[model samples]
Target: MATYISKNLISGEEIVLTAKNHWLNFFSKDWLAYCLSSNEYVITNKRIVVKEGIISRRIVEINLSKIESVTVNQGVFGRLLGCGSFTIIGSGGTRETFRNIDNPVKIKRAFQELVS
Candidate 1:
């Protein structure tokens, strides 16, 4: 999904940052398919947005104020490569996982700073 966040952006909302899918995704058996599946994360002034999917469409939005916690998991290789999965937990126990995302630490920090 080649989405132009700028075009879809709501009035008064601006993207503070953007992230792409991790390089580790290349290791999957169906690497081509993985590439076709666009996985991106966008951080705006008021919310965190994740757009991803292959067959069906999926979009997740979490208001910064409602974010309870953010967790990152990196295996040995993942840590060395600086790519991994992260889970964003919202207030009321809602959770969303973005796997094989690039620069997870930086992404987590951005979210944490905004949420705090």
Candidate 2:
């Protein structure tokens, strides 16, 4: 399914990549947890954004220029299913992680290509 950005983007900021929360997010027996864990990651020309929350809303936006590194953590199960968690380190030592996302390698590559 295609996820569209809810907020207005910059004049030239175009979406380069998009990822939905992994199927594992829905594995919880608790329906509330499953619903709350649903999220989307969008990579644009200028930034990476994560939209998440349950009742109240939370949006995390990281400028591409401030990203110092991107790392993907793939465990045995993750590798087997081709899904992993991604960590992004920013210039000020700030960090964020997106768990159980798809095609982590491609996501990391997209970040590197956009930042450079």
Candidate 3:
């Protein structure tokens, strides 16, 4: 069976479809309550992007309730191929990013629509 999690952008609520493993990981990681935010389109997670001088190697975590807006990032390859990543802004000026998901444009759009 295949499972999916269409999380609520506002409440950090989620609906699981198939895979329970990742879903559990999301909770233990505090991904739902911490890194997500509601948007008219898609949710954004913080970018654990390797900064120039950050030296702590911890597992990336995100709060799904803090997202202020969803910003899509795409290169020529991403745009041409119809995929990309997103950035999210959250409460107290926090942020996150989820990279390289399938059909990001469509997913974001779906999320935006659903949330709306």
TM-score of each: 0.86, 0.85, 0.44
Q: Candidate 1 clashing pairs? A: none
Q: List the candidates ranked by TM-score, beginning with the highest.
A: 1, 2, 3
How far residue 95's Cα lies from its native spot in candidate 3, in Å, is 1.0
Would you give me the overall lDDT of model 1?
A: 0.81
Candidate 1 lDDT, tens digit per residue, 5-103?
Answer: 555778788788898877667787536646775665899988888877666668898888888888999999889988898899999999999888888
By TM-score, is 1 or 2 better?
1
Please provide, for model 3 over 1-116, each residue's C-alpha lDDT reduced to its tens digit, 9 standing for 90 to 100: 22112332235444311111112223444344223321112223422111111133223333444445657788887677665666656667766665543355654454455445
Q: Write down the lDDT of every candidate, Cα atoms only.
A: 0.81, 0.80, 0.40
| Model 2 per-residue lDDT tens digits across residues 4-114 | 364557788998998876677677543454565446688899999887766656688998988899999999999998899899999989999878787788899999898
lDDT of 2: 0.80
TM-score of candidate 1 to 2 decimals: 0.86
In model 1, which runs have C-alpha deviations exceeding 4 angstroms?
1-4
Better of 2 and 3 by lDDT: 2
